[model samples]
Target: MIIAVGSQSKIKVTAVKNALCQLGVKADIEAVKAHSAIAEQPFNQETRQGAINRALHTAQLVPRAAFTLAIESGLYWRMDAWLDIALVVARFPDGTCVEVESEAIVFPSSAVEEVQRRGVHTWTAGQVLQEWGQVQSHNDPHLSLVGKSRADFIQDAVVKLFQTLQARHLLSV
Candidate 1:
């Protein structure tokens, strides 16, 4: 099977690989450059839309692939605090789509402020966290704040979506 992933991020790619492994499937996976079409720090709806957009865009890029996967991370405000959310989307060649999401984690106020006030990207905020020794990687801060690795979070979402497709008999193998 040929699978196309929307982002070049190692975390996202590894998550897909891990999820597929859990399902006992193997495939040739490729990463394609795809845009989220939303702000660097997107809100609830924007985050979901971004994930969908990336999946659709990657599907268009590799139309022959059995599946296209997209993962998007964003921030949302709730109860006077910012939180982190992740959305995963999968698109099949037959025009079927599935989506799953990660639980929200309360984000660091300082990082959120920097993104909102200085117009910095979430990645930049992550970098700041790295400098403070709060985060060990550039792509994930949830590791420190929520005690959950980014790969695990992404894998959970992908696994949920894949299970849904399997339960519905929408996916073969």
Candidate 2:
């Protein structure tokens, strides 16, 4: 079996691989450096759509893969704060699709502004945090601010999405 991932980022790729293993699904992964065609730090529904776009793009790139996965991180404004979340999307060969999101982390206003000032098209919050030495490249910054690793949250979302697929009879594992 094969799984196609829509990113070359090591963090995202590892999260998907870890989720699949935790769920007892064994498969080879094909990682593609896909462009979401949106702001790197997408906001609102753009984040979700970014994941979908990536997954769709990966499916096109690896047509024979059994599944395609994508995870897109973005910020949403709610309850007077900026909520940073990673949205994970999964696509099956039969056109089955499902999505789930990591639990959000509240980013301090300064960090949010720093990301905004740097230009969303050019930098993601994680990259800004990386510049500050809060995290490594392509890793999440929530650990420094909210005590949660990027991979943990994203892996959790992927696990939930795959389970949803299984429950819906769209996936066997």
Candidate 3:
């Protein structure tokens, strides 16, 4: 099987590999550049759409692949605080798709202020978190807050999505 991933980021690619391993499916995985079709700092539903768009875009790049996976991280406002969420979209060869999301972690008010009040990207906030020694990677500052490794968070979502696909009989190992 061939699995195409939307982003070239190591964390995303590793998550895909880990998820596949968890499912006991062996395949060649490739990472391709794909557009999210949303703002650099997407929120809520926009984040979900970005993941879907990326998966669709990746599917276009590798149409013969058995599955295309897109993973996107974004911030959302909830209960007067900003929280981080990772959205995953998996597109099958038959034009069917499954979506899943990670548990959210609250972002520091300062980091949220940088994005909301200063028009800075969430990645920039992640950089700030890195400077403060609160996070190790700019791509997943929630790693610090949630005490979960970046790959683990992403893999969890992908695993759930694949499980859903299996339950629906849309995927088989």
Point to the candidate with the largest lDDT. Answer: 2
- Alpha-carbon RMSD, each predicted model: 2.2, 2.1, 2.1
Q: What are the per-residue Cα lDDT tens digits for candidate 2 across 1-173?
A: 88899999888888888888899977899999877889978988999888888988999999999889989988999899989888888888887778888898887667678988989888777777778776655455777777778788888888898888889876675
Give every collision pair in model 3. none
TM-score of each candidate?
A: 0.86, 0.88, 0.88
In the range 59-139, model 1's lDDT, one tens digit per residue, is: 989988888988988777878888777888888877777887878788788876766775644445566677778888857
Highest-scoring model, TM-score: 2
lDDT values of the candidates? 0.81, 0.84, 0.82
Clashing pairs in 2: none
What's the candidate order when arranged by decreasing TM-score? 2, 3, 1
lDDT of 3 by residue, 23-77 (tens): 9867899899999978777777888889889999999999988889999988788
Regions more than 4 Å wrong, model 1: 120-124, 131-133
